[model samples]
Target: MRNLLMKVSYDGTDYNGFQTQPGGHTIQDYLEEAIRRLSGEQLKITASGRTDAGVHARAQVFNFYTASPIPVERWCMALNTWLPEDIVVSDAMEVPMEFHSRHAAKRKTYRFTINANQYPDLFNRRYQIHHHGKLDIAAMRQGLSHLIGTHDFTTFASRKSTKPSHVRTIFDAWIEKDTSTCRPGTRDQGIIHTFISGNGFLQHMVRIIMGTLIEVGEGKRQPDDMKVILEAQNRAAAGPTAMGKGLMLWEVDYDIASQEKHND
Candidate 1:
């Protein structure tokens, strides 16, 4: 058997999530079905990680072992032909048999987008959270500053997550204004983008971080409070978890050298 790696992108608005559930209306479900049809063999694919429902991905990586002799370069086209338009395999390549998708990933970068427009944006209702206010970008940056470097992130993770180790290193964190454009008539002045790159993330960690930073931006919490929150080591000490719709699995890196390659 040969190992195959695929770079896939999907509009997660319609599907449940990246992983397959009972109803199978997920990105993975459709992707596996297409591969099954092509190779006539049931394949279990491994993804870099699981994204919550309504969370989109720009460069999600996955891998599977197959005995079929289909050319690696053509797999992207073949998969896209059978998969839904929202879910497409952008590229495919053959890899060493021992390579596993999730374990091999060295870093993950997640982005949380907020639409600070006071007016309702019907066009972007599905993907972005509309927080009506002028957020303090400098305050938010100060709050995020404490999160960089190695530390236990239990305060930012979901209480339901039972991972033994909550210690993770955040290589970088930054905020950008109006980093993306919406459809015509969509408000242009109030877009806030928060990007976080780390070795690994706990469940709901990024969302919780965004929410806390937003509180700092709103003046509800001081930027220095981030240090106390991080030291608390409990979920309740942090701010509320942000909505999943505003979050996206922007990129995954398999090696250290590739982590900052897509900073643009």
Candidate 2:
């Protein structure tokens, strides 16, 4: 069986989530259906991770094993023809059989956006959370800085997660103010973008952290509270979960050196 790695981008507003489950349509279900149609094989694709409902992805990665003779380069165009407009297969390549998507992922980066405007930006409303309250970006940056480094992130993870460990290493975290070049009336006063990159994330970890940072930006929590929350290791000590619409799987990083060695 030849293993193929593919990058997919999707607008997750209509789907339940990336994973297939009862009673809801999903990204995986559509991909599987398209695969079965093209190759007439009932095969499963393994994703780097799952995004929650309404959470979009720019470069989500996945891998699948297939015996079909279709060239790897054609996979992207082939799959895109079958997928909905909101979902697109961007790239594809053959990989070593042992290269599992989730296990081989080196890091993943997520971006959460907040529309800090009294009047929302009509064009980007679906992709960002509208927050009327004035946000202190400086304070938010301070709070986000504390998230860098290794820590037990139980306070930020969802209780629904079945993972045994909440200890993850955060490589980087930062905030940025978006300066929109849209038409005069279409753009909002400001857009706050929060980015976090980590070795791995727990369920709802990015959203929860974004929520806590928003609280800090609102002056509801001190910037130093981030350290306290991390030490607490209790979910109750953190802020509420942010809306999934504002979170997107921005990118996934892989160890190319390791994969190349294996291929060699």
Candidate 3:
């Protein structure tokens, strides 16, 4: 058997989540079904991690052991034929037997999008959070600075998380304002995107961070409060968790030496 790694992009608006759950339609279920239909081999696939329901991904990484002799490049085409239109295998390659998707990831970047327009947007509701008020970008930036270094992120993670450790390093964190470019038919004219890159993330970490930033932008919380929140390590001390639809797994990295085409 050979272990294969592949990058996949998916619109998670309809799926339950990335992992397989009873009585739910999930991303893994579809991918495994596609693989089975293509090669007739029952296999278990592993992802970099699970994305919450309604969370989208530009490049989610996954791996599986397969005995099929098909060329790695051809796997994308063959899988796409059986997979739904929302989920597509963008790239594929063979890897050593010791390679594992979740453990091999060196870095990950997640983006949270917010619509700052006052008008109600029915089209972009599934992709971004609609905020009708002006946000203080300066305050948001100030708050982001506190999150740029390595710290215990227990306060930012969901309480339901079973992860053993809350310590994680944040390599980069920033907000981009007034970006007009987006997927066709889903683009809101005015958008603000918060990008966070790190060695790893705990459950709902990005969403919780976004929530705290929003509070700072709204003048409800001071920028300096971020330090206090991180120190408190209490989930209640942090702001409300942001919606999952607004979050996206923007990038994934395995080999830091040679970066992929996607940029943060």
Candidate 4:
């Protein structure tokens, strides 16, 4: 048997999430079904991690094993034929039998978009969280600066999280404006995008961080108080968790040679 790795991207507007559920559509369900149809092999795919409902992914990774001799390039085209419009297989290739997508990942990056404007755009409403109140970017920046480093992010995680450890390293966290107004259909109005890249993330970690920063922007919380919240390690100490729709798993990083060899 040979292992195949696929780089999957999806618009999470309609699906339940990445993981499959009984009587529900999921990214994994479509992927596995497509592979089964093509190779007539029952392949079990393992993803790097799960994204919550309404949270999208630009480059989510998954791997499965198959005995078929289909070429690597054919994987994407064949899968796309069976998959839904919202989900697409961007790249695929055979890998060593031992390479697991979740275990081999080194880092993952997620971005949360905020539509900071007076009115919400109908087209982009499904992808971004709309907030009418003016946000103080300087204050948000200050709060974000405090989040850059290693910390036990228990307070930032959702109370429903089942992860064993809350300690994770955040290499960088920052807010930036959306300068790309060149898109034809997208509303180029007032939009603030928060780009956060970390070594690892707890459940709802980025959303909670965005919420805390939003509070700071509104003057409800001081930027320096972020340290207090992190030290407390209590979920109640953190701000509200942002909505899941605005969150996107942007990228997944791995050892290049390992990834290349896996894609061979």
Q: TM-score winner among the candidates?
A: 2
Off by over 4 Å in 4: 179-189, 258-264
Give the C-alpha lDDT of model 3.
0.89
**Model 2 agreement with the true structure over 123-147: per-residue lDDT tens digits:** 9887899888778889889888888
RMSD of each: 4.5, 2.0, 4.8, 3.4
lDDT of 3 by residue, 176-245 (tens): 8875543345433468889999999999999999998999999999999999999999999999999999
TM-score for each of the candidates: 0.91, 0.95, 0.92, 0.92
- Please give the CA lDDT of all the candidate structures: 0.87, 0.90, 0.89, 0.85
Estimate candidate 2's alpha-carbon lDDT, on a 0 to 1 scale.
Answer: 0.90
Compared with the true structure, what per-residue lDDT tens digits does model 1 show for residues 1-264?
A: 888889998889888899989977999999999999999979889999988788888899999999999988889998899998888799887766677889988888998888887664688777778887767889899989999999999999998998899999999999888734544675445678899999889988999998888899899999999999999998999999998889888889876234334332
Quote the RMSD, in angstroms, for model 2. Answer: 2.0
Q: Look at candidate 4 and give me any clashing residue pairs.
A: none
lDDT at position 127, candidate 2: 89
Q: How close is candidate 2 to the true structure, as a TM-score?
A: 0.95
Worst 10 residues of 3 by lDDT: 255-264
Q: Tell me how far the alpha carbon of residue 38 in candidate 1 is from the true structure, in angstroms, after superposition.
A: 1.2
Candidate 3 segments exceeding 4 Å error: 179-189, 256-264
lDDT of 1 at 215: 93
- All candidates in order of lDDT, best leading: 2, 3, 1, 4
Clashes of 1: 0
